[model samples]
Target: MHQQAKLFSLTDKHEQDAILQALSHFVSLRSLADENFECTWHDTFDWRLFAAKQQLTSRPHHQGYVATLIEKGKKVEQASVSGIFPSFANRLPAVSLAEKVQKHTKNRALLPMLTLEGTVRRWEIVDESGQPALELQVLQLTAESARTEQHTSLNTLLQLLPLKKRSNDFSQNFFTIVNGLQSTKSLPVDGLFATGAAATGLVPGDYQPWQPSGLDPQVPATKAIKDMIDHCLSVMQRNQQGIEEMLDVEFLHDYRIALRRIRALMKNFAPWFGSGGQKLEGELQWLGRRTGLVRDMDVFLEKLDILQATLPKELQEKLMPVKVHLWQRRDRGYAMLRRLFSSHRYRNLTAILTDCRLPEQREGDAEPVSIGQAATDTIDTAWQRLRKKGRRLSSRSADRDIHALRIAVKKYRYLVEHLRNLFPREFANLKRFKKIQNSLGRFNDASVQAQALEEMTRRLARSNDPSLLGTFQAIGYIQASLHQQQDEYRQQFFQQWKQLAQHMKRA
Candidate 1:
């Protein structure tokens, strides 16, 4: 096996020069070209590449960019791509690197993470026979947060970059010996990513949006509730930048989920939040409604491939009118959302979340209840309600009943999720419940989409646009398709509900 290299961090130029003088004792050293290049690292907002133990860096190469993929801290591959790097993964030239990008960063934009802009003073280590066996690199870098507009000056560091030909000749023991003599600290083989994160003030890639599951069942109800609420709000707050820039639809998706979870916590455990609860709830509701249309359109457009797959190729192509109208509606929704999100009320809401203030205690408040007891009561109550609703659902049930049952299931599911720490058995069955809940949700979505199309057609009719004939045809076709989908999804819901009922009964 080949010996890897050592990268040492040294603050003083004297320390680096000392290491170089020490290196002259063993191997012949020759100066190499000074490298003055800027390298920008790329990864998803969540650090997907780091999660996969990969790091991607791009540097200017001739007329294009050379993207290098480092797998587990070793440079593995490189691709020279023309034009500006894209946010979408597949936009990269079709190659091994792009495939990895697509695999890890599906549906997320590839964002420039950290950048190093400075010079690398280089030296070559010559082995016997006068061939270059290894390379020495002294880096003085200006670290910048590619995620933001800040630059930081990093101290000069020394690194040994082993060449392929020197695999058997030079060894890491020399680095180990040299590192021991000085106060210099050698970076770990995979420490570059961690070092970058520290230098850039970026959190580790292990970050995930907060979930209720992280709450403790043993804590007091009010305290746990506050923590969960604040965490979810933080998740929402973090995504504001991505949403404002319209960087990706997922930013809004995550924002909405966090918002929904916050509402869910309040809805299930309303009494725990003593004061200002109703007002906060009202604002949250208003916020949800404000983004509802755009989110709906986002969902529809995102699932368009599946929707199109259900139709024939000829019909799918002809359904361009539906697509166009949907895009127009989505843009309109975004226009409205942008205004609301940027408004004073939105800023106030954000500040409230950011403040992390404890919900005010009402006058003459009672002692807080333990989360263990509160969670048990809440989970059981919601479960009983769901089962009752489930028993009432049938083939002849009104759409209202089905919708009511769907909402009930959702409320129950959210409770179980939020309090799953107290009840593992219930949480274990969550996947089953989620399957049924999703079916119900899809059924409702199909109904809503069909109805929305009808309303759109009416508006189009009022306009009396001559080009709307194709649109009308497409709308009718889509409605028929949606109705068919509603039936299938409904059947799936009932089937899944039966299985859930059997499991619950046995439990």
Candidate 2:
């Protein structure tokens, strides 16, 4: 479908009459559809088609059904197809639509959102050159119950489609007239699909990121903490297939973050987790090291192009050996990842995560801590620690000190973002951490990049590749640039830290 097609939502007979009356005075009006038409729309379980602003529908055809994929204004028909054929996107004539489906839904199957029975009347405008140059479709759709003879009305839309590029003038005039009506409102490409979903009580794109569900602060520590980890596990499960198949770099990145979140939560709430925290941390450390290497490689590979672009054109090609080495290492990391994921130990990675209880009857440990109480105490402790670390740093602070401060800021950030819902409104001002995190993050990245450059040079020196000298020069130039960035970033952090410190004292 051509997204250039204009869709205006209409309300009732008054608006329809007004549009028709206006059209008659300007041009000939015709009802292209003299009868009702029915369509069944299909979308992925998460509403991927709707999210992509596309629709796949099977409407009545001659003696059988045909599937038409509708995007902006372009339509492709698969003849003699019946029922909902959404999952087989490759069968569609258009490669773009198939790729879009694959991208949005990944491997998910498409199911029917709803069926619509409606009437569409189209008006065609003929150009002065004796050509039909523009068209308008007045759409009225409804969802009908097959057994009850009942129907639910959907939005009525004025759809204007240009028949040719030469039809711009008429299209403009028609849109102007439609715009004159107070009742008509314009909509986007997914407008029609949304209206149908609304009428049928369907919601799309209902997927989770990495946030925990809302918890009452008074809830038991067991359920609250376990529930948070379970949510992380679910996200990890969702992205594992994508990572294994090398669908994109983001899959492993997300998987690693999920894993890290679990580790952070466990490490932060160690007392509640008891002595097994050590064993759990070690297991996650092994897994984290594996995923971290790949993730770091991914980060560098992404920045490699931007860094290389800074070099003279002649020197740009010289870094090809470094790029290849990173790619090979990244691929091998994923191979290790796949093997780990398939192992029995991977299946039982969370086996020790079970039956964790708050510590028992030692002086202050008798009563189990409430989720609310624990969250408040944890964030306060992290805040104090962050302030203590920041106060110890100076303009001459070592890179390790800066890295330590960054870790402090991150630990506090994670708790504030995740545990704020468990505390009061005082901790709800999330914007406070933005400036601090951004500056700290940039400084850390530049530090890591410089360190990685020196390490890369050492590793490549041992490889004895003939291009060693050029690679060394390229690494040297890049390292100098990175070190400069690190200096600027370090100063920027001091400024951000001062501003945050004053703000906190005032708060």
Candidate 3:
């Protein structure tokens, strides 16, 4: 790769020429185009990776705040793969595409691009061993035209590629790196994030790092199996309503994820169970697919919403009646999902999972396989299926297949977490799957919300519920805004998918 923009000395503690000296090592700044743009690139991947300095600062009614800054850039392309960053250190904040945009807003030259911002979230995960990890979640929430002045203009040509595969490249590469760096270590309290947690002296248990230890063969298979079963049963029994809520809201999209991961562990690590493993594995997959129905429709509705939002306001208003009718139908779909899940068969499935039997071990066959090995195999299998499904869906342009692909990615991710002991390398790969999953997921959300809005509008036009009309108008704006994001990301998504396909082939 050609070297382009140089990394700069982000801290004044270094000196005036410090930025130049620091960046000069990794990049050559003395290139071209010194006139208009602050930075020029000879290479497509122009990102410079850096860890943030820990700074202590005063806050309201508090002594300090811990803050750390990661990668920073100039004139960066909005949706280009150049902006993607791997997961941050155990405790530090990770950078994402949207967060990168926000970081540059303080620069006057980059202000225009910043104003075109989208969604942003900070994700944190802690493991059993007291290790904490941080990840930044980003979504392109801005309008398409907002990016017109940028060096890259892929946003306008979104319709050129099939919608399903956009952003696959970024997702694939991201996961590859994440998996390599996967660790059960807890993030330290040394960075900018530590001050707040330290100030209260109330270290949150969830923020603790994960440390993997303790594997004993003397432990009985029944005991191990019971623990797994109890955990799932507890979740279902305690948060049974929450699980139902997820299904009702099509959150089964995620629940199926949780279910599938557990299933993979139970099936692949057969020694963990002594006998009856195959039967249980088959049943869990069935349940996963059963819940998948709600997930599929949810995605379908979201896509429909995106298509509808592209219409003129007048056309949208005219379609309001039809929108309401569709929602009632969607409700029926949800009802059907609930009925299936509530069946005796489904209950029996969970019961069996609770008491699953692993394959019997032969003489001298002590440990089946390490958790890390198991994780790698499980995720590898999942990734293969996702890619296959993604390809098939892309070729056929089938919405259901697209949804299935998302479901597969999610399930694989859950397995990645469950089997972290078996395979640390798969985390990065899981991250890649998540990126595309999220992109498609956002589209799915917009689609569902749009369907709801359209239906509400139709009902108001016919029955004239003032309250309903007000709700419809409110929802219409929300859906319209979501549509804007969907449209902007659509083009960027395809370019990413193309990249991912190429990368996967190379790998």
Query: Which candidate number would show the highest TM-score if scored against the true structure?
Result: 1
Question: Could you give candidate 1's per-residue lDDT for residues 1-507 as a string of tens digits?
Answer: 666777878857667777788778877889899999588888888888888888888898787788888887777877888888778777888577788778888889888888887899999876666777678888888878866666777767777877764455454655766588665787887655556667778775545785636566567776777777778888887887787777878888888888888887877777665577788889988998887778888888876667777765656676677788889988888777778877999999878766645534324456556778777777877788789888988877877789888877777776777777678899899999889879888988888788888888897789877877766776677788899989998889888999989988899
**TM-score of every prediction relative to native:** 0.90, 0.64, 0.41
* Clashes per model (N, Cα, C within 3 A): 0, 9, 51
Local accuracy of candidate 3 as per-residue lDDT tens digits, 1-507: 211121111122223233234423432223222111111111000112212221211111223222223223222322222222212222113244335433422111211111122222222222223333222121222222222232221110000011123334433343333323222112232321222233223222221111222433344444543454455554444334433544233234335544655765565455555556667777776776666555655555555566567656655554454456556666776677668668998888766665555544423556554333444455666667767766664433544555566566666666555545445555555566567767777765655555556665665668765645444555566667766876654544455666766776776
**Better by TM-score, candidate 3 or 1:** 1
Per-residue error for 45 in candidate 2, Å, reads 13
With a 3 Å backbone cut-off (N, CA, C), the pairs that clash in candidate 2 are: 1-72, 1-73, 1-74, 2-72, 2-73, 2-74, 3-72, 46-205, 217-372
lDDT of prediction 2: 0.73
> Which parts of model 3 have CA positions greater than 4 angstroms off?
1-233, 242-254, 263-286, 295-311, 333-342, 360-373, 376-408, 440-494, 497-507
**lDDT per prediction?**
0.78, 0.73, 0.43
Q: Candidate 1: list runs displaced more than 4 Å.
A: 2-5, 75-77, 212-218, 274-276, 309-318, 348-366, 398-400, 460-477
Q: What is the alpha-carbon lDDT of model 3 when measured against the actual structure?
A: 0.43
Better of 2 and 3 by TM-score: 2
lDDT tens digits by residue: candidate 2, 148-208: 2345887677777778886687668777877777878877665666666666665556545
